[model samples]
Target: MRAMVIEENGGPEVLRPSEVPDPVPGPGEVVVDVTARGVNFIDIYQRSGLYEVPLPFVPGMEAAGVVTAVGEGVEDLSAGQRVGWAMAPGAYAERAAVKASLVVPVPDGVSDEQAAALLLQGMTAHSLTHSVHPVSEGETVLVHAAAGGTGLLLTQLAKARGARVIGTVSTEAKERIAREAGADEVVRYTETPVAEAVRELTGGEGVAAVYDGVGRDTFDAGLASLRPRGVLVLFGQSSGPVAPVDPQRLNAAGSVYLTRPSLAHFVADRQELLGRAGDLFSLLAQGRLDVRIGGRYPLADAGRAHTDLASRRTSGKLLLV
Candidate 1:
């Protein structure tokens, strides 16, 4: 099997394409012939040594493919089934041995590429809007990086929940994209202060919640954009990790709530994973949620994908196909 192996943690150049041994299914696992793999910022963090992982590992967390083999004790899923999975490593290769419990059936209307693109980021958006803060009808919420993969999904989901969405982006192109995703207001953060724009959009009453995936650069603005007792869901650190803060700051900021969430914790069991993925697929099949595939690269071009995502020059999802 061909895989992009990270022999040593460094830059995107370190993701060397090499021939690796084919993955075989172990008990409770299934070997998938990957058709598409999702590229994410976490892969960049792992490759850059910001997030620690065992050396000589493949660098992907989500993929969609056909099941080539099924391991013992896996009765519900079988060989030849189409499936997708998230939060499972070794997806940067041609084949990945994913635990059967972690895999979800790719339904009739959704394609492999869409499945791969939506699993990690889609579920993250779902968890953020549905569980983390639970956006309510008529409530206003702020979404940072509204044109990006997760941000676009967050905007749509928040709108679906009937919340007025105020989105932050860096360019006119991104602002258009955010508006298309149903954002009631889009702010070019580079042109104006985000908190000020958000306040003006909300008539100075601040939003009910702020979904912030871009950390450090947008953290304080997100805190300031929230209404009293509003929640700030800091799910990713794309700009960089945030600095330590005093507890007094939260109190001073209208008793705002802060939470750092991960997809792993939200889908902690097979039932939860299936439920979330099923809902996302249903929305996709119904044409309610649009997934934009910004770029597609050959499996060997994993390094280039990382470079594009880190540059923040790309919108929507980047896929290795």
Candidate 2:
């Protein structure tokens, strides 16, 4: 199998396209003939040495494909079944072996490519909206990087829940994309103070919650944009990791709540994993959710994908197929 192997964690160019042994299923695992793989920020983190991984590893976390073989003790799924998985390492290959507990059935109406693009980002958005704070009707939310993969999905999900959305983007092109995703307003954060704009939009009252993935760059603004007791869900550190600060800062910032949530913790149980995927696929099948997949690279072009994502030049979901 041709896989994208990182000889060492450094630059995107460190990724090499090389022939590797095909994966074999172990007990309670399944080998997937990967059709598509989702490129995420965590892949960039791993490639850049921000997230530690053993040397010479394949770099991908989500993929959708056909089951080529199922290991012992796996009875519910069979060979040739359509499926997708998140949290599966080594997905930047033609094939990967993932635990059966991590694989989820692809709904009849969803395609392999779409499922691959949506799994990690979609579930992350679901956890942020439905699990982290569970946005309710008639509330408001501020979504940073609102044109990115999780941003678009989170915008739609927030709108679907009857919440008015304020989206921040760095470019004008993303303004249209965010608006299409049902954001009530879009701010070009590069040109204006987004926290002030959100306050202005809400008549001097901040939103119920702020979903911030851009950490250091947006942390100060996120705190100011929240109302008293508003929740700030810091899920990623795209700009940079936030520096440690006193917990009293939360109290100083209108008694706001700050949380750094991770998808792994939210879906630790198999039931939670399946439930989140099922809800995402159901929404996709019903045409209620629109997943915008912007880039697709072959497994060999993993370096270019990393470059684009790390440079913030890609939007929606970037896929390696």
How high is the CA lDDT of each candidate model? Answer: 0.95, 0.92
Residue runs of model 1 more than 4 Å from their true location after superposition: none
What clash pairs does model 2 have?
A: none
Clashes of 1: 0
Per-residue lDDT tens digits of candidate 2, residues 1-321?
A: 888888887888888888988888999999999999999889999888899999879989999999999999998789989999998798888989999999999979999999999999899999999999899999889999999999999999999999999999999899899999998899999899998998899999899999999899999999999988999999999999999979999999889899999999989998999999999999999999999998988777888888888787678999987
Worst 10 residues of 2 by lDDT: 306-315
**Top candidate by lDDT:** 1
Per-prediction TM-score to the true structure, in the order listed: 0.99, 0.98
- What's the CA RMSD for each of the models? 0.6, 0.9
